[model samples]
Target: MPVSPTYRPEPRFFDLGGEYGDPVRAADFPETRLRFRNDRAAATVGLETLTDAEWIAHFGRFVPLPGQPGPVAMRYHGHQFRHYNPDLGDGRGFLAGQLRDDEGRLLDLGTKGSGTTPWSRTADGRLTLKGGVREVLAAEMLEAQGVPTSRAFSLIETGEALQRGDEPSPTRSAVLVRLSHSHIRFGTFQRAAYFGRPDMVEALVEHSRSLYHPDLAEGDVPGFMRAVVEASARLTARWVAAGFVHGVLNTDNLNVTGESFDYGPWRFLPYYEPGFTAAYFDQTGLYAFARQPEAVFWALTQLGGALKLIADAEALTEALNGFGPAYIRELRAAFLSRLGVKSLGEAADQRLLDTTLALLREGGEAMRWEPLFHDWFGGFASSARALSGPRATLYQSKVFADFRFSLFDHEPDRPERLEAAPFARPEPEEMVIDEVETIWAAIDGGDDWTPFHEKIARLRAMGAARNPTESP
Candidate 1:
């Protein structure tokens, strides 16, 4: 059952000054417009249960509720683009509140470009509809790929004018409220360290331990550091396997919850290229697809530096060192899943994937990322002499020929029994982004919805396919 737009949500509040500084109401902006409402995501984060009246009660305005304290800018410094910046925080954003899900996870509900706070500096502190839309698209696609991400809840077009680096003019305005596990970042600790505020640093660590590391009863600060290290290792491994380039994996962007946040200059590679990068400014390829693991390690070191203030230096170093084996294990799991192969010995798995990547790299300009994976999962049919035409050319290359023999004892005709097996599972109807786009397009054109309704029903039937459960 899909969540709908009309569900009512419960209300909760948090003092925003701890991190988020302040907020400006959308109604005050001239170009404000209501652009999109992501009801599906709202439902997932437990906000979709909000009734119409309740929605009005909570977010209709930016006023503080009874006992709700005033917001303040969270003070923190960070390393941006590998250079240390001793000042960075919720410059253009503020936390509206916080909510606990049915699973008892505390999530920060915050807004971007909501308005100016003490940290706003010289900027207008506003967001454009374009930025909001891109975030929606990116978050939805990433969620489907099993990445832990900050979920976008409401995007309201402020109809006010705004300027940005990506757009031509200060034409449209918008505000994006997001739900995230926690906004405490690596920079939070960096700020305390820079100020020589060990007490504040310790206090922040304790707060974080209470929030994200509730199970840290074993080794105090050392255990908490280890948990964060392991979570980051696993998170980064998934980022690499998903072909995601975060572009700017700065210390400020590294959330304590180990979820990916701050979607900027991110791109999913069309094919596997270690040098591929999303941020145009990253000419040095510091945060390229292949370098993410190392970048994560560097960030973890910064984390270790902060933990050192609270715990023993040697213990923190030992915990941070766990990233290597943890990363390899995760990478192997992801690779095996993509290859549609049952458990393979570590050596065999590495050889198989490494050989395949080598084959793709040899293709250079002609390579397509998914096809290599798709083709190999299709039984490397050319090796069996069962593939024909364009696909046969894939095998003709001298680069791939050497590995073909390694995959098969002797190239035989397609395995008769396996050849007829079904390929991918039929996609879900309501869940397909393409179908949803068509429906929205029709609505935008102001067309009669009766015909569209019938079309959707037929398409839904075509999209449904039942099969035995299997992991891939």
Candidate 2:
């Protein structure tokens, strides 16, 4: 296969030696059918020019890219739902390859449902087609909302029927390739700490910093922790602003780079319910809609404990302590950005944020989450457009008075965005549970992918409209 000049392979994970991971091979499926391909994401690494045959040969057949190492199942331990699980790692997938993008940032091409590894335990390492479809949708939706998340690079339907307890049995199976900034999770350090291997912990810290946070001084564990804290805080705030609930926020799922990935049972809020839980099994609402910030902070504390194996405890504690204030700052900025308004000041921004949440809380199910931001995107400048639209009565209610008054004091940032095609619609593009199920039903019942492809196209258009400066 011909290689693009821009494709720069960098198999850096191999540098970590045998202790960090084990060589793995993909399962040979009976058939390979390409389901989805993210050309936009592929363009980042210059893999967009390949023919469909070549694409399948490389991604589907698991052929190693030029100058890239073979797949390796990474080793790590994590806490699952607050329970420390020593037997946790890459059970179903592996780090397929690594490459540098146009911006010179390192990116990992990781897989899900590729095959089994030492971490597989007794469960079959296969991903249901519906699960793969859900992940693609979740990633795209989150990206459109400006959340830091992995890109669903490729999805291939492997001809197989897998048994799953979560949904109907004998469902279709698939393999998914995700493009992400890093796969080094918080659990990576926990694994090293669990084995009482301080040297391994130190080496892992140095490896991560050298690749991901090169700006930090060497041996500056505190600096690294601070950076991770801020990134995690920003991600959590963005999730809240986007009305997304990451159902399972286990330590293994939370990467050190703070990019959200490993989507399962995730959801976008239909309303502003604080206690909304995405996972049906989450009866206690541990990772609820409003408590995401707290959940993330708790994860950071675990990371801090692991880092203490090589760093000063006091410095680590100080870095961990920054999560609360950092979350508050990021939350204010995220909400303001979503509302499409320029900040007046710290005090005024906080006031507007408080009133905005209060209005959502008061309006409850009457005010859907996405429309509030979509209708009032440009703050006061969008008032006439908003008031004339579908939910005018809701906006006119006394409960929304304070939020309405708050918008008056701020100027619209890029008010021209209101003229975009997405804003012309009565409702914003939403990826609620029902819509997701409908799309899957179309596929499951008749293998009709029309709805799936249409949703992606609409979502890309919506993303382009909202983020004018970003590539769709």
Candidate 3:
């Protein structure tokens, strides 16, 4: 496979020191295979480029350094499915090293699918090739859609047999290395809270302030909490805007940096249903699309509980109170953008949005999420009504309910142009879980990546055009 000629990764903030601790051995596998890594991801975390050796050095196996401290095993605990688990941390995984990108940002070079750590709890620490592939695809798409996330760097099939619940059989294992701003999660704090380690929680909060929320470092602890709360509110709002349902929003999965990471069983909505759930095991729909704001607020409450160690109790309460207002403002902004409306200050426009949502729910039109948004966009603004297929009638019927959206006034030409617009377009062929396996097969075979790469670049460009202020 031909590699890109030049690449550079942006620096992350986790570069403190190369602390050696417990080095976990990687499990052996028979299907060992090397594939071209995501060069864009390598270039994102300040890596100038990767030669085969550099890639292998970081991912293939764990090598202990002489005179370096042994791997410092981290201890953490968090709520899983709302149940508190006080024992969870790098059980099956370990941090390999911390690297400084050219931009001087510190990025964690961690290995997943490496052998189990003390936290492994009788389970294999290794990840499957399929899991790694889905993660990469998810990271790329989410990032392009303006969501903060971890990027998959390289995925090497380790060739070892491993058993898993989600797959057909014990399969050859794979190793995944990803780049991110921080791997420290809300569960990290939860762990401390679980153990009644107020000092540790405070330390972690201060560490996060220096890393991702430095502006709040000097503020009173309560004020600092408000800053973090607001950041999280906006982040959740963005997730909702993109039609993303993070199936596992466990406390451990929530990052302190407010970046979305740890993808598993995640799915984009086929249509706009506030109650949509992506995880089969989400029996209660606790993390449904419509409940995200409340879920985030609940997570913030947990964060506040942990931060109380460092902040005054009254101050923490005050900070937690700010979550509602911040979330509401961000949610409104996100919905407005989804409609392609420059502004949504008018009473008429608000009524239009409410009525559209009410009508969709009443009609059970959750699968028609995008068209519903389009209906309002074209109806309220007198834009094109180029909807085709059976969906056109759905749009026409609901949109024409108000005299404001008269049939003659609707621009028939607008639908034609809207048909060409790929925004919110969900291709049916790419929706299946199995199609992901095909994508990996193509990548593994060193077949044409031009089409895939081009599509990624196009998405990146589109995201840039829509939200110029978002980080790439």
Candidate 2 C-alpha lDDT tens digits along 167-193: 898999999999999999999999999
Query: Against the hidden reference, what TM-scores do the models get?
Result: 0.77, 0.99, 0.78
The candidate, 1 or 3, that scores higher on TM-score is: 3
Clash count, candidate 1:
19
Clashes of each: 19, 0, 30
RMSD of each: 6.6, 0.9, 5.6
Consecutive 10-residue window with the lowest summed lDDT within model 2: 463-472
Once superposed on the true structure, which residue ranges of model 1 sit more than 4 Å away at CA?
1-27, 51-60, 63-73, 374-472
lDDT of 1 by residue, 1-472 (tens): 2223432232332322333233344335554344455555565555566554445444434554333443344566788887998757777777666656556677776678777766767978777665665565556545544567887676666667676676667656677877788788888888888877777667777777777788887338888888888888878877776667888999988977888877777877765688988788899999999999999899989978976776899999999999898888877656554444444467766665666677777876465554454455424543343244335566677667665644543222223313322223121222232544455455345633443445433332321211122121
- Whole-model lDDT per candidate: 0.63, 0.92, 0.62
TM-score for candidate 3, residues paired by index: 0.78
Candidate that scores best on TM-score: 2
Can you write out model 3's per-residue Cα lDDT over 191-256, one digit (the tens) per residue?
777677776666666666765677674535676677778878888877876777888887777776
Q: Compared to the true structure, candidate 1 yields what TM-score?
A: 0.77
The prediction achieving the highest lDDT against the true structure is 2
